[model samples]
Target: MAGVQDQLEIKFRLTDGSDIGPKSFPTAASVATLKETVLAQWPKEKENGPRTVKDVKLISAGRILENSRTIGECRSPLCDVPGGVTTMHVVVQPPSTEKDKKAAHLPKQNKCVCVIL
Candidate 1:
């Protein structure tokens, strides 16, 4: 068994357009469980809608993660799943940007600015 500190620290983007990180959980944690954790941190909730874990890509040490065929593979210690390192980079894009009232109705455009994050 792995200790609390031994657990892998998974960091990934959530569907709600936020960056979550350093989530310490056992390697056996399911994708569904991770999804729930993401939802818990979500700013808002939808009454009825379809949610799927699509485009699930793993990233580690500035490289894209491969060979993650199963939940176990995703949490494998042999892989980059410890030391507070991020092994996945998830892009969560919701159908509607209604939550972003400031830019909800704005057209899609790029701005020239530096985001610290």
Candidate 2:
């Protein structure tokens, strides 16, 4: 038991209908860090793929995993196979930025109030 490894292997179900390998990582790996690895392995040709970590969300068991959660803590939500391999779904969202805050043009009109003396 001294040298036993609690390695967790997971596969990512990309939005593009592609699958990533059952990559191995320590059970202690944070969800935040795992996103980076997924980003690295993401296909460059994925036009709608995430451009940054903030643009991606990792979900398991119909819940979005927080950045602070350890991979071990998330194991329960996933379906573990005989080999302990699990799969997670990826959701890509557009990053929130000033671009989204642009104001829309409104038609200019003036109204005058009439008072009868």
Candidate 3:
């Protein structure tokens, strides 16, 4: 058998429902770089949101992506709709840890968490 290696186009959709086309880069491009590219293309108004790329997290195929890692199993909903203001459907997840629960101020400590991706 032969090994097949090819490049894939990664597209990022902002929280404002704006789509950034796939950029041609090696699959090894870091998540941080991808974020930077996405932010550059994002509308000015949307960039003023409370959260920036540093505060936001990226996940693909059930695994949290690291800043140094490349895109794999890429999926949509990378950027979350802050404060439930957008028409886009989102899933909301409860706090997962005691600290998170305390911060969110949930009445219970051990409740199952819901994660909106």
Candidate 4:
């Protein structure tokens, strides 16, 4: 109870309208730490979930928080309202494998051609 002043209530809102937490965290916690927590508590039923922390991205106050940034550094009037739960949007993008990477460079199947005389 004594350290509550430095704690922040945060919850992650997934793209599917699901949430991960409304948990308390010290202001010193890093964004990377939050990502790990997300990975640990990720919804088991969700499809195409992130396989690692690198795949998780957190957005708060309309800004994409960097992994090196701390929670205290992210406090803003737009999202970190006093005594209110801060909702951070979570985006999961799985790392691309060799096959996917190669396919991405390939040309598209359909192309439009136009010529004017």
Off by over 4 Å in 4: 103-116
Model 1 clashing residue pairs (backbone): none
Q: Which of candidates 1 and 4 is the stronger one according to TM-score? A: 4
Residues 1-117, candidate 4, lDDT per residue (tens digit)?
Answer: 658768999999999898999999999999999999999999898898999999999999889999999999988966577788999999998788999989999998877888999
Error of 4 at 80 (Å): 1.5
Model 3 residue runs over 4 Å out of place are 1-4, 50-52, 72-117
Looking at model 3, which ten-residue stretch has the lowest summed lDDT?
Answer: 83-92
All models: lDDT?
Answer: 0.53, 0.80, 0.48, 0.91
For all candidates, what are the clash counts?
0, 0, 4, 0
| TM-scores, each model vs. reference | 0.44, 0.75, 0.47, 0.83
**Residue pairs in candidate 3 whose N, alpha carbon or C atoms collide under 3 angstroms:** 91-116, 93-114, 93-115, 94-114
Candidate ordering by lDDT (highest first): 4, 2, 1, 3
Candidate 3 local distance difference test against the native: 0.48
Task: Identify the leading candidate in terms of TM-score.
Answer: 4
Candidate 1 Cα outliers beyond 4 Å, as residue runs? 1-6, 14-18, 44-71, 76-81, 93-117
TM-score of 2: 0.75
